[model samples]
Target chain A: MCTYRTTTLTVAGSGKGAEGWFPVTDASVYFDHPVHAPADHTLNVDLRNPSRGASARVAVELDPVSARALALAILDMLDSAPAGLVDAATPSGVPPAG
Target chain B: MTPGDLTAETVTITGHGGDAVEAYLAQPLAGPPAGGVVVIHHMPGYDAGTKEIVRKFAANGYPAIMPNLYFREAPGASPDDAAAVARAAGGVPDERLVGDVAGALGHLRALPGSNGKVATIGYCSGGRQSFLAACSLDLDAAVDCYGAFVLTAPPDEFPLQVGPLGHLVGDLSCPMLGLFGADDKYPGPEEVAEFEAALGRAGKDVEFHSYEGAGHAFFNTDRPSFRPEAANDGWERIWEFFGRHLSA
Candidate 1:
């Protein structure tokens, strides 16, 4: 089944694609049939820099369990980071830590 | 051009609004004038697997073509990249898909040795589009392989731009063959039954077969969903259906 459900967001980050590193401006997450993954359906994530062209993308297709684990790991890493360092990493235009 | 030899190449064809779109065309090197098939790629975009299906049609003596549905969104991009871009924007519009299929039909009819008979076969989302094209265009036959959102609407949570096409049954312009996996949740057995009933009510020439124990994408060789027994039988049914309707 081609689940037409997709969640998209604008992100400011760099991702390594086929041609090395590029700034990624957009990200789309969907649970659907994968392009290369062996599973019938997987959680697919495409981090892309549309301004740089379609090839400027880093993609991942993970099983649902693995994707959940990865998501939890990301949150854990962020939660465990030093508070000051996390605040310092915020975008420059944003207000500094109160 | 020896008999049984085939040639597959990339070509440009006019699509919706007369826009030039890239397409893959495959035809037997030498054969009698035969029916043409418009192979619609799945939602994954125009990749090697779909191209292989196009070639399979040619190998079976039918001239086939597949327009890159995402070419407008991401021209020159890799298949996966193009697919991602297209998916982000929203799936292809039904009107645009119809126009593209019309263009592909024209291209097929214009080919040398064409018998002027054409059919459509699509997988996944393309399956629904195949049914859509058959409803909107003049075709000899159409095959819908596990196309969802045809008999029933997607769940409210699904952010799909398209809706159920049950209303188009009366407009179907050709013989239709539907192959489905009984276990598929989208167009589950109940939905398939409703669709079949509607087709019958419309007095349409339709044939449907649901393979037990086979889920969606049973014919997709590259995916884990491939079910050889069902896929093989489905291919035979397709050939028979086409032969009955599209042969010169």
Candidate 2:
């Protein structure tokens, strides 16, 4: 069955796609039929930069367990970072204070 | 150009709103005038597997074409990329799908040596679209392979723009065939039954088969869901059904 449900978010990051590195502005995550995964369905994610064209995308298809683990690991790494260092990174469109 | 040989190529056709859409067309070089088929790719987008299906129809002596439903979203993009873009935007709109399929049917009919008969065959989401097209167009036959959301709506949380198509059964313009897996939860046995009953009540011609040991995507050779036994039999049924309705 094609799940047809997707979670999309605006993301700020750079991803290496077929054409090279591009600023990714969006992310779409879904669990449905995979394009190349061996499983019937996998947790699929696509980081994309629509302004750069559809080819400007980085995609990954992971098993449920792996996807959960990866999600937790990302949160853990973020939590472990120094608070000051995390705060120093400017958010999108904000100018750094001199 | 021989009876057993087929030619496959990419061509552009006007789709919804007269937009140029990319499509893959396959036809036997030499064969008696026969019916054509419009192959609808599953939600995974127009990848190699679906293209192979289009060629299969041609190899079996039916000229076939598959329009890239995502062409407008991502022209020249890889199949996976285009699929992602489309998915993020919510699945294709039903109105647009109808227009694109109408264009495809027109293209098939205009092909040289056309028998003036055409049918539609779709898998997964394509299956639902196949039924939708049949309700909206003049077709000889329509095949629905495990298509969901025909009798029941998607979960409320789902972002898909489509809805149950039961209301359109009365308008179906062609004979219909449905192939389903007994274990598929989306269109599980109950949903399939309801859809069949509705069609019957509408006084429409319909046939259905449910394979006990198979689930969704049994015909997809590249996935773990592929059930050779079921897929093989399904192919046989498709050939028989098409032969009955599509052939001159």
Candidate 3:
């Protein structure tokens, strides 16, 4: 089934895409059919730069268990970073003020 | 059918709002005037697999075309990326789908070898769109392969609330062929029955087949859910249906 549920957000970061690293301004996450994954449904994440066009994207499709595990791993790595660093509160999708 | 080779290529066609969307067209090289089919890609976007389906229709002697429904959202992007973008945008709207199919129908009718008969066939999300197009347009025939939410909406958590289209059954402009898997939970058996009932009550021309041991995406040869036996039978049914309605 094609579940149309999607969560979208703007993010300030760089992702290594097919052409090389590019600034990513948007991110979309959903749990639906995977194009290449054999699973019926998977948690899919698309980090994109709409300004650069749709091809400027990094995509990942993971089964539910693996997705959850990856989420925990990401949080753990961020938590272990120096305090005040890697904070979600920091403004994004823009260059920092000089 | 006249002796001819199959030709397939990418082209551009007007879609909803006169937008120039990329499309794929396939036809028999030297056949007499032939009927046409409009193939709608699944939610996975207009990928290579669906292109093969378009080519299949050509090889079987019917000219076919598939519109890149996500071209505006992700032009030149891979099918998967385009699908992700389209999904985030709340999927394809019903009005846009109708417009695209209408354009496709008109384009088909204008081809040099056209028979002036056109039909629509779709898979997954496209299945519902096919039914929608038939209800809203003047197509000759429609095939809905395991389309869901035509009579029932997905759970509220999914965010897509396009609503049921059963009320339009009475407005259907063409005969409909529905193929489903008894095991698919989306349309399942109950929804398919309801859809059939609505059409029946409307006295619409409808034919439905549910394979016992198959499930959704059974026609997708690359998927884990591909059911060869069911797919083979489904293809046979499709050919028979198209032949009866589309042969010039």
True contacts kept of 1: 0.73
lDDT of 3 by residue, B1-248 (tens): 45547899998888889998899999988767888999999999999999999999988888999999998888888898788778767778889998988888888899998999999999999999999999999888999999998987765655456878978989999889999999998888999998998899999989999998898889999988899999999999999999888877
Give the 10-residue window scoring lowest on summed lDDT in candidate 2 chain B. Answer: B153-162
Clashing pairs in 3: A12-A93
lDDT of predicted model 1: 0.91
Best by DockQ: 2
Give the docking tier of candidate 3. medium
lDDT of 1 by residue, A52-94 (tens): 8889999999999999999999989878987777667756323
**TM-score between model 2 and native:** 0.96
Superior by DockQ: candidate 1 or candidate 3: 1
Which residue pairs does candidate 1 place in steric collision?
A: none
Tell me how far the alpha carbon of residue B108 in candidate 3 is from the true structure, in angstroms, after superposition.
Answer: 0.8
Go through the candidates in order and give each one's C-alpha lDDT: 0.91, 0.91, 0.88
The TM-score obtained for chain B by all candidates, in the order given, is 0.97, 0.98, 0.97
Per-model TM-score, in order, reads 0.95, 0.96, 0.93
Native contacts, share recovered per candidate: 0.73, 0.73, 0.57
Q: How many clashes show up per model?
A: 0, 0, 1
TM for candidate 3 is: 0.93
